[model samples]
Target: MELRFIEINNLVLHEYTEKIRFQKLITKIEEEGVQKSPIIVTKIDNYYLVLDGAHRYTCLKALKYKYILCQIINSEEYYIDTWQHTISKDDYANHIQILLKNERFSKLDSEKDKDILQINTMNDENTPEPLESYIQFVDCLNKCNSFKRVHKNEYSKDSVKVIYPEVDEELIKLLVNKNRRIPAGISKVNLKCGRILGVSIPLQILNENTFHDIYIDKIMNNIRKYEETIYLYEGMIL
Candidate 1:
């Protein structure tokens, strides 16, 4: 409950696990300064352990800020609910590769061979080759109503193909829905890959009820519509 400024170096991270930070986010903080939200930390064994806001911590550290605004709380006083990603980093990389393989894009041989894929724009003078084509490809995947439905094991399915110019607003809405149905997190999608892909909402952000009240209201209302038979059947009754 007590909000105070703490030195960046004094903060300790979770020893067993860590979260990824976004360079763009760090850059934003540097340009605009840290926003109003205070990072949450708890005092344990004379050290402050970051309960949430790892990215913010990293960003502030990168900016070489001597102090950061934070909320100090007792660990026992707060309950933590952690969410793990269903898709691992390697799985996501493989998915991207599989999607690229099915496309008409050309692969350029780089010095490091960093799995860089390029799109051939020899025919269209106006079309951007690499980055633009990459964005187009990702946008195409996002438009597929079945993309989200596909299981992780099916990423390599031969039929998996990227379609273009068809944007499914409804599918996008479902994919990004803040309701409990879809997990919220910071997305790893970036310009390096030519688009945004995943969501990685921090636990602190998720704790804010107001941040998702509207979506939760809609979800709860939808469930109440079937409240009469919601638990009547276990499996497919028809």
Candidate 2:
């Protein structure tokens, strides 16, 4: 129960028994970036133990993070076994612009206004939902498989020029990486921890033109789904 600044790399961990998957984490990693949660300490002595954070440790190891926040505790006294543990997912993202672009927000007098101002105004009957459009984009991106050009699925999404052209390959990959590939059954839920923007991006531009509703809807849906899922699945759902 003590808070100590231990060298994250120094801690020794028990065999990672928890089934931590990468696709499950890709959503938060992309939106929140990295540094989502503190490492779990399961086996601790005068120096170290395996508490949690098996997946996070792996991610840091893969990303080569030099330092991390680890739980400092004793393994002998409170020797309890659990399937999964919950952690924070608040990503301290400095570049909020990536999440909240200038067009995503607007100043109505003084207070900031989110909620896109109806991207599709003219349609008397069939204007697509903004959230739905964002979802479609996520679907399309999943089809691309991150633009790595794999065999068997070599076709490109050039037809989606209106919403997502070839230039937005990276953004598409990010969306798919976040939501589409998540697997179930997790014990700990960690929120992304990093700098965050003061406000959300203005997204009226997505509504300003013809098919912007679909574009904005898809992106927002991914972000919303990501945040909600992170909040809900931090402990048991995985």
Best by TM-score: 1
TM-scores, all candidates, are 0.36, 0.31
Candidate 1, residues 1-120: lDDT per residue as tens digits?
A: 355556677776541122334576676665654343567776755457665666777766666666655667663455443222223334335544455454444434422423322223
Report the Cα lDDT for candidate 1: 0.42
Q: How well is each residue in 54-137 modelled by candidate 2, as lDDT tens digits?
A: 666655555554554444444343333212211111111221113223243222221123221111111112333323334433
Q: How many steric clashes does model 1 contain?
A: 11
Worst 10 residues of 1 by lDDT: 188-197
Best lDDT among the predictions, by candidate number: 1
TM-score of candidate 2 relative to the true fold: 0.31
lDDT per model, in order? 0.42, 0.34
